[model samples]
Target: MQFHHHGYVSGDPRVRPAAGVGINRPAELPDEVDVLIIGTGPAGMLTAAQLSQFPNVTTRIVERRAGRLAIGQADGIQARSVETFQAFGFAERIIAEAYAITEMAFWKPDAADPSRIIRTARTQDDPAGISEFPHLIVNQARVLDYFAEYMANSPTRMSPDYGFEFRSLSVSDEGEYPVTVTLLQTSGPNEGQERVVHAKYVVGADGARSKVRESIGCTLAGDQANHAWGVMDALAVTDFPDIRTKCAIQSGTGGSILLIPREGGHLFRMYVDLGEVDPNDKGAVRNTTIEEIIGKANEILHPYTLDVRNIAWHSVYEVGHRLTDRFDDVLPDERGTRTPRVFIAGDACHTHSAKAGQGMNVSMQDGFNLAWKLGHVLEGRSPESLLSTYSAERQVVAKNLIDFDKEWSTLMAKKPEEFENPSELEDFYVSTAEFPAGFMTQYAPSMLVAAADHQELATGFTVGKRFKSAPVVRVGDTNPVHLGHHATADGRWRIYVFADTALPGATSSTEEFAEWLASSPQSPLAATPSGADPDAWFDVKVVYQQGHPSIDFGAVPGVFKPQVGPFKLADYEKVYATDPAADIFELRGLDRGGVLVVVRPDQYVANVLPLTATAELGAFFAPLLPERKAAAVLSAATEP
Candidate 1:
């Protein structure tokens, strides 16, 4: 909060840039801005891409490194993340170049061989019908490239400021910027000089050794796995049948090897855990080289030999789990006496083994969650208190991740002999097979999500969990589309109306829904012009159960075809009724014809209600979005 030109105003970024001003342009390191992000990794840049949509808020991303990473770190994109990419319109770009990892085979100790392990378990890597996209194995560098390209092309035209290293930080009400960030120009065109940036909010996406975390006085809690592993990315020549699929090999005596199939000219990544490391050392640094790492891999798979033709990247590091006590903090002014105001996220908040392929995915999600909230506040669309949910929401997720990491990373580090019961490891895999996809993460009820009970309306689609999606064919093109496609992370709410045209009086009920939606003071569509523009605050769609001769577009309510947003019944894109629709109703535990679900920008279900709750719809959006002046006027005119 700051005492500004107007008395005591919270720096709500959502407050749209005053009346006719165009989107904020790339300013020359202004002393004040909206958000300052550190690091150029996926998490940091993804945050930038999210901010790109809100051209009103100013953002600057700085990296100590001179340029972007080329190869060899974080390659797996989880199903949940793939869905996120699809929402942003880039999942196809990644899917085109990535290797899909759908199957896994685990090798355990063989009593006869004594040296090499034998296959003991094989399972599908992803849950069936959980998501439309599969887990994709593409290099982190390639992912970053996609994010960077997207951000650079957005209205904001933003990119990372390279060769700028963080120096110090503080918060001040009197200064031009609420949060002041000091930087030392290490290289690039602007070198050898000090620069300062003042921002309304700060995101510490600076990786494991986070300077932002230190500035906020946040401390890491948790321990590292007592194991050192050498990871290598390479184009290999091998006799392994499962080389293209994700595989785990545990040697009877030596070590364990985890194989991850990759993109780029047929490459694969191997994580060779060489066993126990000095617990106190940060990385368990050893005098090991690439050749030694490959040698360890050879021992794990004795019969299936591996010869690397080109090594993309190699690194040796100890496995560990650590998380910051708090995700955000306040800081004093440069004089060492003021309020704290810095926040940390991504690797700055938590660090764990990368074997599960969660480090980058979770980090990118951290940015995804914070970006919208910050955008809302900076733009004055929501209260400053909305900012508080960032830590509350993400920290729980981080803690859960650390708990799972400690167990999985430990089991993964052990040699076959180290395991007392090989079956226990398999049990662990089966029990938590769906954990890697990241869809199970549920946020506690808060300001954004209602504490309301929705069990009777839709049983399986819980309030806090992600909205379940299923395949359905569009009425016009007859093209099949995922129901989840409507929940893009583009900063708008979604109202999915499942209307069954086959039922008696279904048309009247549908018309009533649209009428109540437009008339209700709390309706989401109340804010949209004629409530039909695709670019409005909210949008709606109907899912007719029966298709073609059974129920055509003509049967839907004429009211459903609002000429407001970009879509209408005439377009047929607004209506869906097709084959294979039972999967959705079954998964959602719906009785027969339909279900109405309210989905947030992040794709979490906020409320589930039957069509009978049409009047309650306005009440749902009342707390979620800004109060509607149009609603107030309508209420006044209708008042008895």
Candidate 2:
């Protein structure tokens, strides 16, 4: 459908125009906007979707392409990215359209016995407790489609601003409300016209060779290796009985290929590395044709033969692994007072090999992390200082990704001639199995503060101290739901009330605790309280010093129950095991709290506040609340 101007200001009379021929028109510019996101790829769309959630924020996305183009790019979606999609309400839909890989078989060609094949089994079923959804295989186009649909239907719908390419950008030094933006609409009849849009902030979600990064003079500092790889998605006729069963197949000739089964019938993907081909020539590999890709696939499979069939899609890419030393390169002269106003994210910030399919996921996450901070800052809920932490948190993730990719590329590039026999390759496999999942390291526990002494507190499971983010812990009985998921849906702020003593007829004091939460300002804490049994909710045991159930209220020396009175701090420590002082202070919701526990939407502790006086709680949480009212107003806003 073509978009026609319903009305125009200045000069427009009833000069009934004809339908067939097009009319020359000037570029239409938006008068005002909150945020201007460049590029409608995964990063751009996600940032738009997130920022659109805020009522005060208005978002506009500019894509060079007119519609969704299915150029086969990235294929696999990591577990963490899937969890992120769940938050956006599109994870299940993606899973339905994608293929589920249950097992991954790694085979190394034997050196001494060249014909022999060494196989080591590593499958998703083995790690049952690690993640709810292990791994999914889906095309990048499908992912883009899902995001496009969500954004179109969202309350903050992206208008007909597509096909508008970014030509230039100018950021302001002042931290005032409006940051001026100059955009050049390079499309249609009025291609040369420049449209200036004044915005509060600008995000450079553009790809690797970002024009925004160039305009701002941001340099990507790291090792840039020239690696050429060919990735194709097509239908193939193969005689190998178990070809579809394998996840990754590495041949002895230093050539690695990945076979992923797609959802629509038997569509599969074949990734092959071209030897000595010019990295810059995109057509060199694509011209090899489907027969060549299938031939390479068959060579990797070796003993098994395959037949060439119809080709659906194909592409060759010159990949690189690199990262910027700084998110924004601000010298000492430009430091303190004037930070770099222009910021780069996604591929612009970091670049890596496509060996493990981490580029897309990391890029999408960069948008997710940065969008919220920018939104909050624009809304004046947080100081500009919060923006500094974005680079701190994301840079570490990018570095870790590069290191993991380097190791994985090394493993994939291992020559079979180096190993003595099939058993030697098996030894290497066993040695590497001890290492945790690559994602675990990327999302593992670390000390919140730079120098924290306690083990639990440093590791991020402490009860009293505040954390930068909350982890996904299995807390329920039958379902074993993620704590972050439940807590995020309930509200940003939560009050975990626990009584030192239990009232009469209360079993574990958890019931009394629930009652207190129900009556307190943070009432209606549980998302599905009715689904869980009342008794099971408070499953913790309330016992005496000798470990026996204490029924008498006065018999218990220092124990306190939720429905009962407060007990000695020493008795409270035995049951919870966390810092008693922190728990008591936090549970009471008292003022001048040492730490203000700020949890992110992902449920990870963002920061911990240690307010010595109880009066600072109001001041700490005032900006974070969505309502934008005083902390005291929370009492009137909470559900009865």
Candidate 3:
């Protein structure tokens, strides 16, 4: 038998405040397209690429910039972001050219010698076992380049039209494209010329001054951070040993500086503390240039020699933390009916200091979270209510991010005397150590994520949190594979049967597991109409402690892999058993078996229950999914 990858996409977004709504049908959508993405940054491009997985979904992306970005943007890719990248096949491309920042060294002025700075602490950049990849560095422009290449190769492809600016979006009564977009050409011969485009959905990936956000009536609320920072991405000459590594340098007199090693030609990125700059002063921000930033770097790293051989790009920015109150929105048509046709992501929805590198990664993750839900609704597989989760999840993440940036940016600007408070420093460092890895993000329970009450279930692999991956072996073959590889982010909800058939003192029988699966009324996914697409609806698979020698491959029951044809299996693509090479079960806190876990399309644990609790599973999905009129079908079949 040959194995092939099933085209898929996964979603992982952030936390948001709670609100309530039932799914309401739009009056109608026009004949234009399924999706339209505005602003071709990582957020917009990623949303376009993921939409390509659905063959029937039509997509278009537009950019206001004259061309691709040259420089000066977010560059850090955390562990969770790497996993998200791997889903789209761009992780290796980045890893090939980009620098993987594994170790972080912190420097402070020597206690007895105030003039010289010494290493205070050194540790791994990411927590162990968080992900397969670590924190990585590449310019934001290069990241956009990778997204462009992926979109070019997608099965359902769309290219971005540059120099196009979005003017406004209006809701329509009915047809294919319900949302009408007004666009203006911003550059070239067609500059100032206007045109109109129709789309069923419009995503705003424009920057902080997002017109889409304003047009839709969303407001950003937060205070400007007191510190001013200078960021420089350049190819430079330096004698610092840890310059090659990502480091935090704290000066006794001048201020603090952060080092980020880039991928191309020995480039390095620096964020230098420029002290307090007036928030109202636009000239203050514009006046600080590459030379000014370089001079500041010299002040911070006094003992270490520095020279800028060639600066690629630089910017002077104040830490102004602001976030929108909402993420998902329903724009009113001329008559004022609400439909969730307009949305926003990335810096458009939230803006803050570049210190944590969450801007690019979080924006892309938002795209990943939303694209598939739109794909399902456009294809008529899922209910419109699913769209509400986007605002619910991502807004929480944005709020948490703003709160964190407040403490961190303040500490970076404070004098050494303020660092004497060990508790405050420890709290800030604890967050610094955790949040950037992209693992700390967790969503609260709502309509989508129904689960057993278990928060400490194996340390972070709880209900409403991300489903971590593990290594297991195939039943017919001893080949080892990470279970996560099978749970591709391609937008399929999964029900995992952690089979304990071979475990000692196990009370649950294989027959019981098989029976529950075979009965439509008893299975959690029983509500899905019989004719529904398996690829789009739900996937069933099993994992076990070990395969019993007594039961031959042919003797394995039909529930594990069902049969519709002569001697063919039904559901099981591959049977996975524990692998001895790695103690993955222990690592993920899944050593105890005989449980059932329901995972959302975005790869988060939606529910966890006993293997026998199929009814609970059915109840969980009942509210969120469309129901099948099975009785009508059965009546027609009987009459025929």
Candidate 4:
């Protein structure tokens, strides 16, 4: 949203001026690239969108499909994904068009009748208020379209190459572009023809039956749950009272239905339980018809009826949970000795039942996590070792997701009478609400994630979790805003300094820290390339524990007023004060002595430290960022 920094633009600011490979980009696929992505699913599209910001890094995506996906099976958008969309600058636009889930209604068989079902419990969505953004219901295709638009408008002008299917690939131990890929044309005049391309790194965002994953010797290792469910999106007249609301209904017998209201008001989706599938049955459950699904739904509703007008989409799938042994081509024995050249993400690495509505949301997070590391390593901002954290961090999260979905899916398939407690399902739903909302992920301590030794500095902003935003007043314009909303998906580290109650010019902790950060070679700010924007590699912002009127703007430290752009204009938006309406200091439990919070490019809190812990802060970033002397050597080596 910050435009006209380099120059004026009367047209859309989203459509950035193309540079590097984006300038008059070749219509034909290039022979070599920095990063090559396969498939245009949620993981692939988001990967391309994130890498598009780095024009200098040549990134290409290829999809086997002839064109964009018309209808996507996934529809649920969690709060965490909405927060990510805000970073990419499209959350508001998508939310305006998508349906916002507010409450969930649970229905159970009536005791008196035993045939008819009655609403037992109604619980609020996100009862814990984990995120400011709401859980949404939007088509997966539309989400892909938004990322596609972002990619098309990015500085790289990156977009997927349709009709290219991955045939095979091999990685060389020594080479500039280590991964040599063989792509076959799936359509057009060049159908059946194969072409060769090479890349420094490759990402497999292809679905469960990914050839890339197979080529890397990784296999999904899990079995089916022997449960089958029939899902359909329809337009119908339903006598069921909670049809418009998200509902979980368990019948007197063994039937059940999960009713979810879709976007565009009238359309809704129903996942009707189709009973258990026998282990010997070889996909016989898939042949279940729309009429049979509707019949099963009617049985779950008892006296209520569904007069179907039209069926938008319908499919039958057996619930299965599977995850790959590893996400990358690096074997266990060669982990520390070798860097990964090929990586898998999304369904390629982990898969589970779609009923939990996590297939696409978790996949997007996978891309967001991997793409930043790719951008950093390829752009020489970070070392190759940074690539190792992607698999280490996301694998744990995927395992946790599969475990939770297994329990949730089982409860949905179970009969009402089978449970010891009648309200077990609803109670479980409320207690574990944060997981489905996509706030349960907490990356364990590693090289990228610091230990929670200083978590008390900002209790609300938990270490290793997403940086929850709170209201702050922008001192420059006296406008109230969520502090976290300013951070974007441009792949830059964020350092937030919460100043103690001290005057701007006074010799306090904040002033001394800022001066050190502005001058010291040990500071991460010193790593910024010469003649570039001062805040290019890192975005440093300061928030004070005081009102806007009480602050002195001119007396603020030079570090906060970074000189950016060609003309070196002082960016004044970096300084902020706590909003009196909602005090961030109190909301996030900031220490009165001041605290320094370091957030990764993916928006997770990387480290939290005290104001005077300058050496500790520098040590945290030292291993991640390249040293000045080493960077100079790399620059010379890369020169033509």
lDDT of each: 0.73, 0.52, 0.70, 0.91
RMSD to native for every prediction?
Answer: 7.2, 12.0, 6.9, 3.2
| Tens digits of lDDT, candidate 3, 1-640 | 1221222224211111111110121222223667878898888888887776666677778888888888747888877777777766677778888888877777777788756677777766654556777678877788788777666555554457788899998877787778889888898787898868888888999889888898788878888765788888878778777778777788887688988888864888999888876757765665777788898788778678688898777888778899987875653232124447889998999988888788888888788888888987887767777777787788898888878777677776677767666334434565467676776777788877764564333443578767787777766666677776566545678887776545422346544664555555535445455544323356666677664333345555444553322223244454667777665456666536466777877777888766666667677777666664443332222110
lDDT of 3 at 233: 80
Best-performing candidate as measured by TM-score:
4
Pick out the ten consecutive residues of candidate 1 with the lowest summed lDDT: 13-22
- Candidate 1 lDDT over residue span 216-321, tens digit each: 7888878766678888888989987788878888887678888888886588889987778766765536667989888888878887789989887888888778
Candidate 2 residue-wise lDDT, 249-300, digit = tens: 6667567666667666588776776554554755565467556766776677
Please provide, for model 4 over 1-640, each residue's C-alpha lDDT reduced to its tens digit, 9 standing for 90 to 100.
Answer: 6778897889988899998889988888999999999999999999999999987999999999999999999999999999999999999999999999999999999999888899999999988888899999999999999999999999988888999999899999888998999999998899999989999999999999999999999999997999999999999998888888999999996689999999999999999999988999999989999999998888889889998999989999999999987899999988899889999999999989988999999999999999999999988899999999889899999999999999999999999999999999999999999999898899999988899999998898888999999899999899998999999999999999999789798889999998778777778877777766778889999999989999999899878987677866778789999999899989999998999999999999999999999999999999988764323422222121
Ranking by TM-score: 4, 1, 3, 2
The alpha-carbon deviation from the true structure for residue 620 of candidate 1, after best TM-score superposition, in angstroms, is: 3.5
Which of the two, 2 or 4, has more lDDT?
4
TM-score of each: 0.87, 0.71, 0.86, 0.98
Deviating ranges (above 4 Å) for candidate 3: 1-31, 173-176, 187-191, 330-339, 422-427, 430-432, 454-460, 503-511, 518-536, 547-552, 559-573, 583-585, 591-593, 629-640
* Candidate 4 ranges with C-alpha deviation above 4 Å: 629-640
List candidate 1 segments past 4 Å from native.
1-24, 174-176, 280-284, 330-341, 500-508, 527-535, 548-572, 578-583, 591-594, 614-616, 631-640
Tell me the TM-score of model 1: 0.87
Task: State in Å the error of residue 579, model 3.
Answer: 1.5
